[model samples]
Target: MLNFQNKNFYQSLLNLSLYLFVYYYFVRVVYVYYKLAKYISLDFYRVALFVPAVIFITLAAYHYFKNIQQLKNNIYLNSFLSLFAIIVLSIIYHFIFRLDYMSDDVFSYQIKNLSYSILNALLGFYLYQQLNSNSSKKIIFVVWFFYAIMLLINLNGFALDTKGVSGVHLMLGDTFIIISIVAIFMNINHKILKIISLSAVLILAYLINSRSSFFSFLVVYLFFLYKEIGLKNLLYLFVLMFFVAFALYYFDLLRINKRMFGVFQGHSDGSLNERMEQFKYGIEAIKNNWFFGEFAGQAIVHTQGYRSGQMGAYMHNWLSYYRQFGLVFFVIFTLMFVYAGLFILKEWYLKNTPIKNMLYYLFVFEAVSLLVFRAYSFTHVWLVMVMLYSYIHDKNIKNLSEKA
Candidate 1:
């Protein structure tokens, strides 16, 4: 069903590559950091990704140049101007105060992250030019399918143990939650397959033991499912689930975190408590250097002692941006996300299309995760942000043309 014309083919390839990177970039990070891939060096992974990205960019640039007039007013590219400006200023600030502000290694890592983000941003913009609801669905599903297969091959089964359940780590839970929710809500004809898939993912989420991901999955799933099946049906389903939960709890079959509910009382599991502590530290760093933000202080804290390397000891939320990239950067990124989210809500209200529903749910998940779970600089976050922006831009243009 994919359009394989010259430009479309290249753009689709770029799209596939970007999705692959987003879905498994965390896997790459884990593998490199843990030295798990004995046959594949970090440099090999870097080169593998970097080379393809460069080639994709080159081909995309050629197509854009060839169709300059048509592609000149790309909303996706323009939307990131403020973000790009902040990035430039941050880089200049770092260079000027390199000695006083940050170490060479930290700076290098940041630069590398920024470079890849920019490349991904470019690819996102290119894909947006040809993107539609159907294509978006295909790209996501295809990448998720392959990633699932990769996990199966590597683990030989689900990775559920005393350490926890994950395709690799907590990251896998996040990815699985998104795709699973989408799959559940999809209007596919095969009811048996859909039910089986949803059931499988629900079990997977439970086994993962990620309170954030499991509850998030339940929230979105139940909310949408209620709308689809109505309140009466939902109540019946809830009653059934309640009895199931009671049975599981009575028999000690439930494996969920015991402290999951303690978050309401400001006392939760260690990981939840640790995230709160990180937020406190992030706030202190921001306060210490309000204007430019205090990466050096955060870096020092992370380096002195942490589970994840210097860059990994973040608050896992938007505060990470506030602590590292300065208030201006935080404000710009926040506004962009907020505006895009509002646009999707509006579109869903007016049209109520399946694509719009998917977008809205995705926005909900990303918004919640970014506020309390996922880090600000996550590659998938950036991709989703741009996708929202492009969809908004496309809708606005279409409305304008219709009016004219």
Candidate 2:
């Protein structure tokens, strides 16, 4: 009886770990933390954001002390070393160069922001670890339940109070819910439950009306169907797309919106045009500081007197790394993402993991949509990328081990 109890306890812990990953990566856990912290005090936001970091640090220390044998594993050591190096380098560059924009220019405040970013990345890694665990189904279900609650709250007008309703949040949340539904379909044996789960997700996506997410879902769904339905059916999909485009065009919504379809049309007013102006200025800044570009946070300072409030803000372009960090750093950063993408693809193809293949396809669809929508940074793209890499890497390792 005692042994059985102990097994259940460990299983619960493992399940919680997996849920945390899905929660942290897809849901606005940080935003939720911020909302709760706001009632405590404005200062609490910083403390709240640091909570995950503090916990992760404690876990690392505990593992070092209690699991010394496991600590000696080269894979664990290398991941730590690489992560440490990246964090240190990014910090040095951000501070020495002043790479981000903040209302507070204090070094400690900047450190807090960097810590937040790193904490987010670590949370993403934790999620990856949990998702790959054997008991992932339980974890996925818990995450989905909490996610549904959050969605209900948001829909009912309980805004997170951190940032306003953003396209990024909507997209990431919808993606997670969609993926969770898919996982349920794969793992759950009940046919009726699977159909219900899928139907619920489809309804929820439509109700949300997140144009990018809705279109992305359609694209990926068609891709899946194409694989199942053959070339003749695929041609019909293209024809359908053409008619959809024509209808949207005939209505003048496409021209008036200036975005692909009408998905990004929510902020299509002058805001997008303003972003374009900012992008233009950002390009000019890049040209001017071509070598060791301006510090991260210094752009706001440089253009402080500009009439455009948004222009005197941290530019949204992911390419800002090039403008602020320099070509070398930007190249390295781009290479890292490219390597992650290729690694995901290679593993998916080699291992024939259907889940990983679906995830890779989703990421590819999202990446393309980002180019068209400029909504990547606002969403959980970084977390999603890390999760995809982790999923593919673990699947590949498992396959290789089985073969060996």
Candidate 3:
């Protein structure tokens, strides 16, 4: 009995440590970005995030290895194989095109981006596994509390300096927090508390003025309400959306020429037109080098046509992966997305597990939002996609065997 108790205590400690580290990491990133809070350097922030992620990944890897027998029953092997193929192809594209040969900044940025992606992938997989383990409500509550703290910090930042936060940061941060809230709602079966919490989360999303967050909320809510509300309610929602679009157009909120919008529009004089020009240049660049495109490190400035003497540095297109690598790389990258989507749909139609269904919708919503609104090349989006794919693939195999 004493030994069992000690084992339980150790497990609890490990769980708590993981929770706290994740909470701190996410909250700090949100605070720094939204608050316009300064970090010493991108490298410094990367180290801060990467260290805790490495610790978490080590623990998770150990747990998986210890439970290797269970993995034999799962399709993790196939999922890992697919992931490896994608990485190998990416590496080939990197070296063959001499992608990082142009400048030190390009190589450094790519390294940091890759590091963040791997860390997020590991963290997301661990979280997904934990969700399937014990006491989900407690874990979710802890996560939500950290999310709330992060939201408060972001709001405080905006209140202090209206133009401080970038459009991309606002979109990404709010999307992450809102998704966490949605996950909690899905996992927790409490009707009243779930309604209350969800409403609060919606309000928070609205306050952030993140178009992506708003769209995600609409997508998730309508998906949940679709069958029950029938076509009439759907029509009403469509009408509402139409009016909102009209209002945005009338108010000049919707700018198609430039890939920018939101509160920061007024503060920066050249930002709107600059982004538009960058998008235009990106298209031209892609046209010129459609097959192999430019390397990742090329000095592809956005100020080519502008005689106004504005210094443009980075490619604002998150989809710039196509130009950075090539059409071949883009095709492979797209196939991964297609595979993930089809796998999720298959699981949803067959097994129909609540967790799987929620994840499916989340993946769809996030992918669409990324394409429509902002460019998050270095964010946790890819990692989240990988985790979702892995989970759905595993669950599908499990269901098939159970049926057999």
User: Whole-model Cα lDDT per candidate?
Assistant: 0.63, 0.52, 0.56
- Candidate 3: which stretches are off by over 4 Å? 1-21, 30-48, 56-103, 149-175, 178-182, 190-196, 234-273, 297-299, 305-318, 349-353
lDDT by residue for model 2 (7-116), tens: 44444444444544554545445354334445556455445434544766456445445555544554533453464455457557665655344323344644554554
What clash count goes with each model? 0, 7, 0
lDDT of 2 at 15: 46
lDDT of 2: 0.52
lDDT of 1: 0.63
Q: How do the predictions measure up, each by TM-score? A: 0.78, 0.64, 0.68
| Candidate with better lDDT, 2 vs 3 | 3
Better of 1 and 2 by TM-score: 1
Flag the better candidate by lDDT, 1 or 3: 1
- Once fitted onto the true fold, the runs of candidate 1 whose alpha carbons sit more than 4 angstroms away are 1-36, 61-76, 99-101, 126-168, 178-196, 258-268, 296-298, 302-309
Task: Summarize candidate 3's per-residue lDDT along 1-404 as a digit string, tens digits.
Answer: 00123455446435644453355445455556555345466566656656666766676566656666666555544455455455456555664665322454555555556656555665555456556555654656666666666666656422322245455445444545545643564576664555456556655665555555665665665654453356787689779978987898799875332222443445453655555766776677789889876544124563445322122343554456676566765666666767787777777657545576567666666666556544434455655575676676666668888999
At residue 277, give the lDDT of candidate 3. 64
Using TM-score as the measure, the top candidate is 1
lDDT value, residue 79 of candidate 2? 51
Off by over 4 Å in 2: 1-16, 22-52, 61-87, 93-102, 105-113, 132-135, 145-218, 234-268, 297-317, 346-354, 369-379, 391-404
